[model samples]
Target: MSSVPEDRFRRSPVPLITHGARRTVLRADDGVRVEALYEPSPGGGTAGPAIVVAHGFTGSLDRPAVRRAAQVFRQYAAVITFSFRGHGGSGGRSTVGDREVLDLAAAVRWARSLGHGKVATVGFSMGGSVAVRHAALYGDGSGSAHGGRTEANTAAHADAVAAVSAPARWYYRGTAPMRRLHWVVTRPAGRLVGRVGLRTRIHPRDWDPVPLPPVEAAARLGTTPLLVVHGDRDPYFPLDHPRMLAGAAGDRGELWIEPGMGHAENAAAETLLTRIGAWLVAA
Candidate 1:
């Protein structure tokens, strides 16, 4: 048997695909500039639907893991990937998941602007939480509990939503990873590390009025198709989180628990991604 080349595991020199990949900068509702990349499907414009990818915390569009996920998603539909504010070339500081909904909304609107009849959002971790809120707040052009209706919210709605490794409620410190994550978001020293070491600029404060929880948002999603995916071994959040989200989603939701998976895009297998792509296409 032959072993795979070491270089194969390293970052590839060539880009994913350049033919129909268009790069652009989108302006969030709050005026933050979000760097985004869009790739048309391999099957051309006839592709089923557009898939907008919302990356996890500390992740950027250029991250290899994100790019790899986009590569897989692009196989089924046009894919749009973007960096939330405070990550990569995007401007402004991260409000963690608070204001990140605007970032996901911007990306979804951009995907819709491409003339795609249907748009679906797939988010990981923090991005997953943002995706849920974005869908709940804008899915049916309805205003959120905390905010009034806006043109951006009306235009940014998604037809389908998928969240991977998302937390059901906030401020959870049950797990070591969640505890460390809280530290990073709450402490000055940890914020410094997040900004300098992780290249992620975390907000120095907490959510003011507190955005809707994932479970609450899931309950408001109505008929929008929702997929709640989580790993049994995920260290950041336990199985209860996904259970809560799935329960809130009720008839419009589906849950998938990977036996040995760890977390988010990094832990998602190619087969799983393929299934997700199929789901979006069917949606």
Candidate 2:
């Protein structure tokens, strides 16, 4: 499955901010395809830390918000923003956050292959959950449609991460929308979709898959500071998700809530990046 030709995200004016090698990282995940844009470090002075940005659901690599964040990160280290499999240049169906997590691992490996050792991961929405899951544990092969183990795929990261930013944590599942989607995928009347062997009830649908919860994922980190940012008015994850994560991690993580903004608002909300950028100062 190649990337859908039409992407709705608007391109940001990043030329004024970042200057580097403009290329693409066309990669695959266990024969399933995934890819990212490669902007090599400005390659001078002290480019100590590298970063890889992940996009949210239904979002392509060039999503407007991601490009803007990539532009912001370009000033610090190498920036690689990629599309999950089934979204852009990559192949396969979008597995919501489950399979997407593997895509992030692939991107991280690509960054490391470029000689970037100390890395920082930034993910938004579904991407955020993937980042947290990968940081906490190694490959579990949730990518398989058959739910088999990919144990041979060992952890690639050094665990010396700078920081992890998960803007919105869609933790709860009993919410109105999720319940409806769950019913759509599980109800006997919804058997038509099942006949095609399609299952829309993903982890985000009132269920979480990782062995470690988001808080455990953050606290599981040794020294790498984790930043948990969420919008109080977020309609998707609701308001309490980040609070729960920060509360769970205690000193292991930091939480910030954006008032009056809802889900996906962190990407487009006013002064959103400023706060996120400030919170990202390598701890």
Candidate 3:
């Protein structure tokens, strides 16, 4: 991979606040530029904790779905939302969910730097996979994804994690939606379509050593709290995914199988989002 431009990481003056939120650029330890937004809780409901939201594939912090989720989350606590690498204003090509862990770590660290005593992660679809892996790799002595660079950083670790509509293992082509998504990521012509039609950029290369799968990562979460949510109607992944995650999480995990829910953020209802917000507060 090519090195990111040095100017991408040059410190800028604090971002001008807009609509009660501050938008800024963050640099991952590996030098990827991650675009992030911080929104304080609207009222005095709760003041010390922050929830970092990670969006699914083809999603960006600028997308309406992400913005809506952030708005709902802020009702309970401060919210931090960001684009994963290769999405929106972020700097690198997407490695799908592999190296995206670094992007999430950067956002979590920023939430800590902002003085929030508690930080939790709520992720949708591909973001859910990233969230679980992040909690495992960044949690206290759980082991590191990037050598010792991201290890043992309590501030960077999420106190809790909620994975919604995520997959359990990689290379799952059992569903039509997932098969279509794979084509978009693996074929040159399909990648062109993703870039032109979907506004998503995918790296042509595959995982090197292959990071731990989401179920395995959930098992390694240790004392960290985990929530696995899936909908019976979700078209991408079946109920088996969430069940596997909850099983691996054992006593540390909670599973919620929604009745009519469909997929990720776009399909999530405001009521469900609020419930997720409540769960984070209680955590």
RMSD of 2: 6.7
**Evaluated with TM-score, which candidate comes out highest?**
1
What is the C-alpha lDDT profile of model 2 across 133-194, one tens digit per residue?
66655423233222344532332442322222342234346566455544544456643443
User: How big is the positional error of residue 132 in model 3, measured in Å on the Cα after superposition?
Assistant: 0.2
lDDT of 1 by residue, 157-257 (tens): 99999999898998889988778888888999999999998899888877888988989999999899999999898888899999999999999999999
- For model 2, the superposed segments whose C-alpha errors exceed 4 Å read 1-12, 15-19, 25-29, 41-47, 138-155, 158-171, 174-212, 265-270
**TM-scores vs. true structure, each candidate:** 0.93, 0.71, 0.91
Off by over 4 Å in 1: 1-9, 12-17, 46-48, 143-151
Stretches of candidate 3 exceeding 4 Å from the true structure: 1-18, 44-47, 141-143, 149-152
lDDT (tens digit, per residue) of candidate 3 on 1-283: 0011223322423222335677899988789999999988866423478999999988888776677778788878888999998889899888889989888988988887888878999999999999999999988733366666433355678999999999999999998888899999999998898888877888998888888999999999989999998888988898999999999999999999988888888777779999999898788
lDDT of each: 0.85, 0.56, 0.84
> Backbone clashes per model, in order?
0, 3, 0
TM-score, candidate 3, is 0.91
The predicted structure with the larger TM-score, 1 or 2, is: 1
A best-first ranking of the candidates according to their lDDT comes to: 1, 3, 2
